[model samples]
Target: MQELQQHLEATEQRLDAFLVKLTQRAQELLNGFEQEAVNIRRNDTIYGQAYSRFLAATRGQVQKLREKVKEVEETQIMPVFYRHCTQSSLAGFSSMVYEWRNRCQAKILQWEEQLYASESAAIERAEWQDYETVFQSHLQQYHAEKEKVYCKQCGAKLAINQVYYYTVYITCTFCQTQNIFNPGTSARQLEDTARKLAEQRSRPVLEQQQFYQQRERDLYMQAHELQLSLIHEKNNQIIKEKQQAIARLEEQRQEAVVKAPQLMEEYHRSVFDELNNLLPDLREHHEKFYRAITTHYQ
Candidate 1:
């Protein structure tokens, strides 16, 4: 009986050692998941705030520009006496309006740059958060499995408070008999569990590869679907951006539509007025202005 007790004690010691290793490993994996989740959440919060700011500012500016364009169209018209009124005050007012419009358009361009940068950053950060969630879910499953204790004999499973240990030594949880799991016992039961875990670890890389390969195939089919919805969200943002750009361009074109004929008429009148000997200099200056404006519009 004493010898049996000694064997039981030794077996219990080994089991304790094994459990400690498993628990530590499981905790390490859980810690990694938790840390990654925290980082992802932090990144998401920052990106979300920046994106919201970009959207708000851009929307407000575009709306203001649209309102200004409407007001200008309603309140001002190209005067027939524009050529006759070459006074310094008139030139200064015209210069001020031009400068204001140019400044507003420049601001719109700056906001466009900010929107593009913020949207791209948000997309990348969102993807990272999604990946982190997947990792934590898998880690949760592994930790749950690690909490189960297995029988030393017949490879049966054991649970907390499910079976009592015999003699405080190595004994089968199922059979309640010593020597059943003595040396030479098959490791097949634990081997299967370890194999499953190993397979779990490899799943993420496999999924990522599959995602890339399958992306082209399902693009059209899933465009209307909502499962992989974030991609569609990014696409919608791109479409909205393009539409805003088109509206701005159209507004500028309409403004030019009114100004073009007037500019040509004024050019003819100016040439007639200053035809003495400055024609060459005026033409050269006009050509330069045309080139610069054309470059800007393009």
Candidate 2:
């Protein structure tokens, strides 16, 4: 019993020390990845290369740590605990080993999630900035030509107050004719550009909203999966009760799913609101475009 106790104590201490070292190593890997991220543009091919390497390296480290935990559990901890199975105190040592394994696994999962989120956010921001640059260029071109609209009815130049995406009836100063001005495809495309820019800007908020919506879906799927597994059982009465429980879960899921469109509606409103703010001069066009798209949702 004394020797078993000594072995358990030594194993626990060694495992604890291993966990500390694993954590340090993981942090070191993360630090290196972050340093690479600082130098690489998210849109560049190099960014993907760096990310793949980082992911592989981190996953390898995690796998190694997991294998070490399992090794210790099977070869050292379990053997010692089983040899002294009659000793009740040895059960606590077994529990300690299990807890350590769970903790380590949990930490690894958390680190991976954090890394993924960081990468996603970085990519999103980079795309947003790229769109912003394009929008600014379009804006500059729009302003420079705002007063350059020539009256098709007469040779007179029309001093337009704002950018028009669609056909506008502008009274000619010289001919006094209502010249139907269509700003052509290039100008019409600016509305699309503005809309895309706004969407990119609000992507993070949309993603957050989508995350909860996805979570609800995942919960429903998990419950449905459980219900399917239970259906395979031989018991009839228990299956009936389980089916009823799953039905309730499905009902709840339906309720949540019904609310999903409203969330999308909110996101759309937010995107257009942002669009209007970005190009307040085109508010009328933006509102018309918003109404045109949202009518289907309604």
Candidate 3:
């Protein structure tokens, strides 16, 4: 019983060390995820070039982490578990080892569970919703600010939502002179951007101006609603699918955790099998080494 207890404690210590290594690698994976989050902002029109490189680097790191985990599992964890599970030891100790192996398996399962939960927290739906809701509200304020404008020509007071381009010409009813209005500073740079010339320079340019004003209002409404409309669509959209990418990355982390032990055990056992295959040939060499050492005493 005492011998069995010692073996059981030794097994636990081995598993504990493996767990510590697993925890450290899992933290590295989490840090990579956080770094990606910082690089990719929600409102970016395109993924930053640096972030594109980061994704590739992150995959390499995750693959390396998996390899390390496999090494630990095969080299440290499986030997302990197999030693207890096989019951080649004292008759009473087999039962104790069986219990110890089961306990070790439980610890492995718990490690995977904790890792999955940690990764999932990074891409959780509720948190994504919160991030977008705040951004959408801020975007709303931005739209409201852009909508406050008036016609510089007639001072006729354009609608709250006017789509002023680079340069537009308007005629005042009170005065009959053409007034060139540049609603925004960039109008001079992109002066020819508009397809129509202030309603094609028609006599009733005021009505044309009103038409353009209404068109701008419609566009503004669309832009504002769309920003808030498809948080889910944005997740799946081919161009800026940040949310989906993050979710996929989280799944990869979870997969690594779940597969770590099983993969290690399979590979670890194979390594031992290879050693066993060479053992018969090695026995002659082993004896020669022993005899060589014993000859020194003679």
Candidate 4:
């Protein structure tokens, strides 16, 4: 396993290095093309008139190199992806093919556009027409103008040279199963397949998210229940404390009521003793009158 991992890592590094090299090469090719176009506009040299040819050649070489890189990566990746990885890697294969297909299509379009932009010049009208005719011929020759396809399963080659049913299907002539080389497919079929694949890629992630969400909800519910139980216990403790306080206050009130009659009788006796002391002081101030009044009252 370690060795395989190391090999894969090394391969990835090499692939990355190659991609950098390819990018640099592509930039250089584009710069060369722009320079050639400038030279053509300036009428720099006899060869400058043929600058479009050089540009086309450079683009074609770049495209071939790109295809070579794709082939290398696919050859390395496909077998491992199928044998070692899970179902998810199937989408990776589709992506790899899509990239390669788009790269090829872009290159073809670039060359076609370049050819359309550049035209050969001549001195006279007839000469110009002849030049145009020859230029178109060469353009067709250099481009080959045929979309070539091959069967992935059986290695059968198909070329689009003319308007025919062959150009539409371009399938494997040997096996009519549409298993490998169906370059031309119906628009509806393509759309449906793309939609289905998009759904498939999302389905796994969606299910995983739902599972996590359900787990979170269950944990929250359990925590909430525990919180509610703790709160109920605290409330019960508060109720018990209130009951104890009320009971103590009631007992104190009962003791106060029991002592009330004795306290009132003592207060009345103290008041009578105070009045008797005051009467002796009054008799000392007025003795004769006090004696007369006392005898009369008696």
Off by over 4 Å in 1: 1-88, 91-96, 119-123, 126-298
RMSD of 1: 36.8
lDDT of 1 by residue, 9-38 (tens): 453354345434533543444344444544
Candidates by TM-score, descending order? 2, 3, 4, 1
Q: Compared with the true structure, what per-residue lDDT tens digits does model 4 show for residues 136-180?
A: 344344234234456556766654433221224455667653533
The reply for model 3, stretches above 4 Å from the true place, is: 42-67, 81-89, 124-298
Q: Worst ten-residue run, lDDT, model 1?
A: 181-190
Candidate 3 lDDT over 69-177, as tens digits, reads 5576667667866765676556545555555655565566556656655665543321233322433354354345444544565556444333343356655455555
Instruction: Report the poorest 10 consecutive residues by lDDT, candidate 2.
Output: 95-104
RMSD (Cα, Å) of model 2: 11.3
Residue 76, model 1: Cα distance from true site in angstroms: 20
Flag regions of model 2 displaced more than 4 Å: 1-129, 150-156, 174-180, 232-255
Q: What is the TM-score of candidate 1? A: 0.18
List the candidate 4 regions with Cα displacement exceeding 4 Å. 1-3, 44-51, 86-298
TM-score of 4: 0.27
Q: How far is each candidate from the true structure, as Cα RMSD in Å?
A: 36.8, 11.3, 31.0, 49.8
For lDDT, candidate 1 versus 3, the one ahead is 3
Q: After superposition, how far is residue 32 of candidate 3 from its true place, in Å?
A: 5.3
Instruction: Estimate the TM-score for candidate 3.
Output: 0.37
State which candidate, 3 or 4, has the greater lDDT. 3
Assess each prediction's global lDDT (C-alpha) against the native.
0.41, 0.66, 0.49, 0.44
